[model samples]
Target: MTEPTQDSFPVTPTNKIRVAKRANYDRDTLFAILDEGLIAQVGFVLDDKPIVLPMAYGRIDDQIYIHGAKAARMLKKLKEGLPVCLNVTLVDGLVLGRAAFHHTMNFRSANIHGTARLVEDEKEKYDALVAITDHLAPGRWDETRETTKKEINATTVIAVTIEQAASKIRGGMPIDDEEDYDLDFWAGVVPISTSFGPAIDDARLKAGIPVADSIRKLTSRR
Candidate 1:
């Protein structure tokens, strides 16, 4: 039990990382992993069964927001203030090793434990939607059409204030036995990455309309 630094979240028993070497509790490290990820897997118990669903999310400081249809089962259950776990992972590469048992993937992942509650404030809900839209593509919310009141009424948004979080990162080459090095089996890392392709236009899109600057900039960087 090492104590967490002031900048890191406290390492409670539920959030403690088993492999201390791979554990990262620094605020920057945890936030970076979460921000870079596109999808979060939310886990919770429902009807005595564990359910995990992939969702798009937004982060506002320590709070993470997730939304769905108002009648969706996952959202319905989470809004009851039940405990939940959220996980986001970005795979960097495939770590190939001489021995099958040593093969692994290079990745960065963040896990959060918290209780979710329904967002009742109108302004906060609107801001959270903007954050979620922009998280998909920076500045996307502003470039798109305004959200109608009816649409907002049909959506259910829940906010989870991160109570405990930890990140685990694995990188570089795989670790193989000393004797396996001379076995002549090829071993190396196969790099992997996610990139955006050329933007496609909608079939019904007006001919005079052009791609938005946000999309142009995002695709250019990728």
Candidate 2:
């Protein structure tokens, strides 16, 4: 397979910087971090004012898809073809050091900059919504309320080309100065983790309708 194209997001020299060597520019690592993240904060400029909104997103082939109710004012500007940026980040751990100034958090983060385009085609809109649902909780859309023609028309979906992006990662314990390490103090990493639990059945569901295998699998193994 051909290597996916990538562009370095122009980070202003004045922007905050930590461990520069841990910054990753490869497309594969960036995409993997994006895929694991559950929420993306989309940023856009409208009328000289900047706005940021957190929303769910899904990756499709070579594009990133996101949407909101068509009537929502937040998405109105986006649907108007405004340029937008999407960012997803996951904090992996808390790196503590003997020196207070050296405390830091390990993380994996991705930021994508691109012009947003509306999904005007009906079939494409359907597929985009499906991708959004499936990306969050796989196989759940099939069991939930399907989007109606009116609902579909009332929602706005935007697809942005996957370009001008990169992922930055920082992990492991604190990298303290030699003098700081010698100071007597406790220092180590506090790991961060995510887990799913038992499925809660709806009180209204018929007793005979057993939990679907899809959900059963999610809750079966911690």
Structural similarity to truth (TM-score) of each candidate: 0.96, 0.86
lDDT of 2 by residue, 64-140 (tens): 89988877887777864678888899998999988888899999998777779888888998999988987776776
How good is model 2 by TM-score?
0.86
**Mind giving the per-residue lDDT tens digits that candidate 1 earns over 1-222?**
457677898888888889988888888888888888999999998888999999999989889999999989778788667999999999999999999999999999999999998998999999999988998888999988889999999999999889889999899999999999999899999999999869998999999999888899888897
RMSD of 1: 1.3
What is the lDDT, from 0 to 100, of the residue 76 in candidate 2? 74
**Range of the 10 consecutive residues with the lowest summed lDDT in candidate 1:** 1-10
For each candidate, C-alpha RMSD in Å? Answer: 1.3, 3.6
Model 2 residue 151 distance off true place after TM-score fit, in angstroms: 2.5
- List residue ranges in candidate 2 displaced over 4 A: 1-19, 220-222
How high is the CA lDDT of each candidate model? Answer: 0.91, 0.79
